[model samples]
Target chain A: MQRSNIYILVFSAVMTVLIGGAMSLTSVLLKPAQDKQVELDTKKKILGAVMDISTFDKPEEILNLYKARVKSVVVDIEGEIIATDDKGNPLIAEKVNAQKNHKIDREERLYPIYMILNELDPNVVEAYVFPMFGLGLWDWISGYVALESDLNTVKGVAFDHKGETPGLGARITEEKVRNRYKENKKIFSDAGNLESITMVKGEGITGLSMHEVDGLSGATITAKGVNKMLKEYLGCYQSFILNTRGLNGIAIN
Target chain B: MSAEATVVEKELKVEKKSAEPFLSKRRKNIVTDPLSDDNPITIQVLGICSALAVTVKLEPTLVMSIAVVFVIVFANLIISLMRNLIPGRIRIIVQLAVVATLVTLVSEFLKAYSYDMYKVLGAYVGLIITNCIVMGRLEAFAMANKPYDSILDGLGSGFGYAWIILTVAFFRELLGSGSIFDFKIFEAIGWATFPTNGLMVDSIGAFVVLGILIWIQRSKSGYVEH
Candidate 1:
């Protein structure tokens, strides 16, 4: 039996209302939890740069650990602290998603620095984590790089990308790749001078010095992208880091 | 056959079910056939994309399987309930809406509760809307069946799909990462010298494993193509 046009219209109209209502209600109800999940993920990435987050760990434990060890500071391109609004609260670093801010002007952008502290003294800063973003062979690549108190050597790094080729360029997220950045010199020469690290092709050869690490073999373009990203992001943080060296009681030439 | 008749008999008086045995033979068949003879992945060959994509890890594949089971069962029940009222012309649209809504619900719930697993599954959860198995069951079985029988059919088909992908993931994660459920099984056994197969981590590995699985299943069951 052929259904009449009126029946089709009524059925479709009812389904639209029912499905739309159900979906929107679910979305509204789950928004808070979803938002919290996103926040935790960002924190996990930031914390991941400095320490290992076990897959089995609970959110509260991770959040407590992050709160205890990490301090977020927002700065401008000129390395000046960007003061908070009328209220007397500090700006949250995770809120400043660097990838989204990448398209904006440097002066208007908020640069977040995650300070990793030592075990004994919270005042004694162990490393500074700067978020970096750049183009990969296919899409955007973003990550965190932790700098030693000297602000020249890399303590550790963690990278995540979108749409990179699987098993090739996507290997940037692998622990082995990110581990290569640990203790390697990111800035060369003087304290104030900003010489970003270079990712050279090939490995196991002699003379792999400060400011260089072996790149992924088949992912030349992605390796180059990582090199360029480090230079650009680290350069943005140079002046602030240089000025803060003395405040932290670190002797500089 | 009597169990099928009983289900059809109970269809009209859904509210007045006569305390039928929980596992009628037809209902049992509905849930069990897909485990082997009617397997959705190997036999029917539905939902191959997700089976390949998420099976790279055992944990995520298991999560995806549970998500699918929840979706298919609920969708089957809902569609079966509304089957009679639905206009034939707009039936497909209604099915799509139901599946999409269910998928979105599952996606939102995952994001809220299992953030880590949610990240691993990523867009694939949303892509569940497109998994042919869900729609295929809705149209072929649920649309003509009673709610109770449709639920069993959905469960059966879902498990059939789950076992196949879970099996594939077992091999993939073990060989690909030298791990099971993120535990370094190979290292724990002191086989640190064993070289992990890089190929197993890729999509090609999923295809190869599933291809062999299909061959084995078909051969044992004596299934022949038309």
Candidate 2:
């Protein structure tokens, strides 16, 4: 045991304790900022799907632009519109008997965002935007698909995921893959015209319905999940779409 | 916590101790080890996780390669410099602490300055610490060499690792993305950088890069046979 060696051990130990402690503290301090950035990024993406903003790329810029155009509302499962704050009543007054909140399997509680823009002093383009939950190759995937006043023709759409292989199946987010649903692709009509988006063996999906998106090749499971999610959630919004369209003479189911 | 600490304490009556002096041997150890047939990635087969993940596009792979090079080189130098001052039992812990700190700082710089590139890198930047080249150098050679030589040794092996990684990334990004560093070389993103030259961006681009690399390596010097 040389005297120099004794000094070396103590120095190393002290440096380790100091360095590790500092690294851990920095990460903890920065965690909030990082989390906020992540949240804002997702918010920007959501806002972008409902509105076309080819000019803006930054989230803060998108948020500013959205402030002028979009108003979010929480809605019930039925035709009646709930207030923004949900303060006035627990149940609907006019259709109190018709609306059902008692059944456990059929709960009335759900969150959906509506996009409203005032075109004229009295006229407005108000449409309810909702989430489409589905499955992809690896896990549960979800998306936001907006509809026009018609409630059938898509205004815009955005999809994201939990996990999918990078090059092969994860191409669902790519423009070409998503454009199928975005191009006035009808999801709902007088009847559920397209029961589900097509998840077929090969590409080139001819006229089945306007809403059907051809599944990715070698990614059938994910494609099926997307179809199933779109069908079920779109079904939930049917009554709201019908009520809003009928009031405006939009002819929705 | 043993008789040794007690005996050393009793003999020197010391408060703090630094690492052992192993710099000369470590310098030679790291420098000679990787260049030989027993290279870490090639022979020992370390760090292939990053190889696969970043190799898809060349820019990410190149960034990843450069990051590993920086971490390995500086960590080796810092570890070697402090080696003589490290405690015998806690040597590995000390090495890891220093290496981890350097990695975090470099990762932060990339994140704050180059946001787009940072997004592409994502978790791979932090994963540079897990790169065996850094640890392998610290443990095998960095802990024993003098700071100057140890740093050189660290960089030498780092270069050894980067040479292969960059070569791979170069081919992958160019062919895969139709340009290196995310630029479309045939058509400019806008004006100055990559003004006229932009390469096509597609999946097949990656396949072409991989094939060309395989072809180039095979057709080159005797080094390809290995």
Task: Name the candidate that leads on TM-score.
Answer: 1
**Deviation of model 2 at B116, angstroms:** 5.6
- lDDT tens digits, residues A32-151, model 1? 989998888888888888778866368898888888989888888888887683377667777877777898876677888899877789987888899988988978988788888887
Residue A233 in candidate 2, Cα distance off native in Å: 3.6
**Residue-wise lDDT of candidate 1 within B62-141, one digit each (tens)?**
99999999999999999999999888877898998999898888888988999767756766888889999999999999
Candidate 2 CAPRI-style tier: incorrect
Ten contiguous residues with the weakest lDDT in model 1 chain B: B12-21
| Native-to-model Cα distance after best TM-score fit, residue A121 in candidate 2, in Å | 7.4
Candidate 2 C-alpha lDDT tens digits along B70-182: 88888887778777766667677677777779889766666545544565665667778788778888898877766777776776677666666666666655544456666
